[model samples]
Target: MALIPVDAALERVLEGINPLPAEEIPLHDGMGRVLASPLHALRTQPPFNASAMDGYAVRASDTLDERRDLSVIGEAAAGARFPGSMGQGQAVRIFTGAPVPDGADAVLIQENAESVSDRTIRAAKPVEHGRHIRQAGMDFHAGDLLLEQGRRLDPGALTLAASSGHARLLVHRRPRVAVLATGNELVNPGETTGQDSIVASNSYGIAAIAKEEGAEIIDLGIASDNDQHLSSLFAKARDTAADILVTLGGASVGKHDLVRGALAEAGMELSFWKVAMRPGKPLISGRMGAMHVLGLPGNPVSSLVCAELFLRPLVAHMQGARHEPDMRSAALGAPLRANDERQDYIRAVVRHTAEGMIATPFTRQDSSQLTAYATANCLIIRKPHAPAANTGDDCRILMLHR
Candidate 1:
């Protein structure tokens, strides 16, 4: 099959995808969850015209003259509103958040009012109408859509939901991702191994990336290069009802690459198996029943780049949240050679200077080098068949998590 452009490949992966079914969860547990329905305010904020600061509530006309003394009436504290009304020459002692008494149009802040006697307070400053008062529905009104559908509930959003009288929220379910690694030479971290054995590291990075995007990970561990091992892991992933089955390594057409055959046998309808990208060219996209499948290359950098480019969006879209990478313009720190047909995501160290963002691509961009990927803070996007550029040339960069 011909290599597919990166954008076309991603389009294929996300075609016809919709958010998962919604489930109601407590508002306290709503952080990072996507809203399934529009959140409307249950009641008007402030409920009534209330004092914005500790002050004396009075009729605006009564306190307009700083020389005039107003008679003090009943006090109105928060949660204990003054039931009676206030009229000309009447001032109610009100604290912050207290409901302004009826007929009172303004609050003379305590700093601007002086106590003349036990029953009288004099205005030190002219009290204007509506001054220091929070009117009803100032923040939000009942039936107002405060949060739209598919909005991610961040710290502020959760607080807003609570303030809007939402004890619970309807949110899209978190995407479930099952990760499986393949190869006879692969061993788990911290495990004893002989010659020719290499510790498997891609799954950890992949799982971390998925989790950062609010995905629940089910680690299928390492599968040796054999049909039986690969097929059994595939079954486990299906039995676990994973939303996306991510297989590491074994995505290419090499002799030991068995993941493709196993997934195809397990009823996976293959979408494509190659992308026109340098580090992550052997990427795969498919689906089995309702579960999506992605086969990533074995190289460490390749797997992570693919995860950022493809898997992150897949997980985010599944939960009705947007997780696109942060892309921005920058100046090249050094000269770069012409790019090949495949798009290149060069790991680079980015710096902030008087000249704005400066991204310097690492000299070595081997797919197996995890050290470079870890230390780099951004990826310089070098388009396919591009000509050489100098140090000061403008370039585009994708900011990494670091």
Candidate 2:
């Protein structure tokens, strides 16, 4: 098959995808979850005109003149109301969040009033009507649409939902991903192996990426470069009912690479393979029943880059959340040679400079160098068959997680 472009491959992977079913959960646990439907206010906030500060609720006409004295009739605290209405020259001591007494149109702050006696207080300053009074439905009203569908519940959103009288919320379910690592020369971390064996490390990083995208992960452990092991792992992934199945390594065409063959034998329908990109060209994608399958290269850096480019968005899409990479423009900090047929995502150190953003790519971009990938903060994008460029040339970059 012909090599597919990066954007085209991503479009194919995400075509016809829809968010999962919604489930109702407590408002407290709704944080970081996507709203499945519009949230409306169940009741008006405050429910009535209330005092916004600790003061005296008095008739506006009684406090219009300076040095005015009024008799204290009653007191109103939060969750309590003064039953009697305010008569002429009568005032009520009210606390914040307390309902305003009937016949009271203004609130004279305590700081602006002086106690003349046990029953009388004098207003030292003139008071305006409706001052320091929170009107009914000031924050929100019943049946008001406070939050729209597809919004991710942040701290502010959660507080709003709670204040709007929502004890429960409808949100999209988190996607579940099953991850497996494949290689004959690989061993688990801290395990004894032969001189030629290397420790398997791709599954951990891939799992972390999946988690950051709000996916629940199930590690299927390591699968050797044989049909039996690979088939068994695939069956386990299918039995787990995972939304997406990610396989690390064994994607390229080699004598020992058996992931593609095993997946085919396990009834996987191939979508596309061999994307036209550097360090991740051997990427494969297919479908097995209802589960989506993605085959990543064995090299650590390649696997991570592919995950960021492909898997992250897929997970977000499944959960009804928006996911877009932070792509930015920058100036090349050093000269670069021309590219070949494949596109390149060069790992680089990005820094804010007086001119603008400056991106300096590492000297070596070998896919196996995990240390270099860890140290880089961005990936400078280079298109296929591009010409040589000098320092300070314009470029685009994708910012990575620090």
Candidate 3:
């Protein structure tokens, strides 16, 4: 049977997904979380008109002469305000962040003034109105919305929230992900490997991807290739209250492919069973009650690729987070053969050239190879039935930094 297109598959998967519930968390621990609602400023910044530098606060009209001498009535430090107004020829000594005196309309830096006596000072240079003065609400005003809903909190966002008098933030809860690996010949990474068994590596990679998408993982370990074992694992995943369940391997139609059967037993509705993509053709997507499930191919490279192509977006949608799809084009470093019926996602090494980005596909195109996938920083895309491509041909590329 033919495979489904990437766009169609993505649309089907995202149709029913919904954002998780909101939770209140401390501001310090809110980084990377999506805000549930708009955040309003509770108080105005610089509650009072203040001086931005250590200097003298005086009326703008008083500094019209070459050297205007003014009597110092009182001093103002940060968090301290001068109670009375200044006279026509008088000034108040002020420090950085101190509230400007009531009658003063300008501030001159101390460098522009020289002390002449105990109560008087002389202007060393010219002065302008509003110089070195921070008016009330200069940064933000009260009742103003500083951040909108669905914004991911970053360093600047956190600082803005703190400035708005928010001790804690309201954000969407992290999506819960359950991982289940299937195969009778699979063994734990730390266990001594049997001649017929391969070490279980897919779970770790999938878990890492899930965490990067802001989802919490609950690992169900490996389930032997049997209906009983698979059923037990499915039940355990449900008990953990997982919002998305990911099953590694056993997605194709084989004697040992018990994932579909088990899902049927668990009352899951199969959405799609395959995609038009190389290495991950056996990918399966389904819904089990309120939770979504993604079945990936057994090969390590294929499994990780499927997780990136499908699972990551599902998790992001559930968290109310926005991410740009991997949509980039680059020049092919070498000639490529005509693509078959399956869409190709060949592992490649992408580098910057004087002209533009250059992508070269690895020699071995097998799905099971892991080392090549590790060294590859990009995935070169080839549509199904695509014609043969030569060097410098334009192709889509997906950059993988992690």
lDDT of 3 at 279: 83
Write down the lDDT of every candidate, Cα atoms only.
0.92, 0.93, 0.89
Per-residue error for 72 in candidate 3, Å, reads 3.8
Tell me the TM-score of each prediction against the true structure: 0.97, 0.92, 0.91
- Off-target runs (Cα >4 Å) in candidate 3 are 115-120
Per-residue lDDT of candidate 1, residues 1-402 (tens digit): 899999999999899899999999998888889999999999889789989999899988887688899999899999999989887899999999999999899998999889999999999878788999999999999999999998988999998889989999999999999999999999999999879999999999999999988899999999999888888888899899999999999999889888888888889999998899999998889999999999999999999999999999999999987776799999999999999999999999999999798999999999999899999999999999999999989999999954
Q: On a 0 to 1 TM-score scale, where does candidate 3 land against the true structure?
A: 0.91
Candidate 3 lDDT at 399 equals: 84
Residue 281, candidate 2: Cα error in Å is 1.1
Compose the digit string of candidate 3's lDDT tens values, residues 102-121.
Answer: 88989978898888998988
Q: Cα RMSDs of all predictions?
A: 1.4, 2.2, 2.4
Q: How many residue pairs clash in each candidate?
A: 0, 0, 0
Report the lDDT tens digits of candidate 2 across residue range 1-402.
899999999998888789988999999898788899999999999699999999999988888777778999999999999998988899999999999999999999999889999989989887899999999999999999999988888999999999999999999998889999999899999999899998999999999999887888999999999999899999998898899999999999999989998999999999999999998999999999999999999999999999999999998888887887999999999889999989999999999978889999999999999999999999999999989988999999999964
The most accurate candidate by TM-score is 1
lDDT of 1 at 379: 97
- Model 3 collision count: 0
Output the lDDT of residue 199, model 3.
Answer: 92
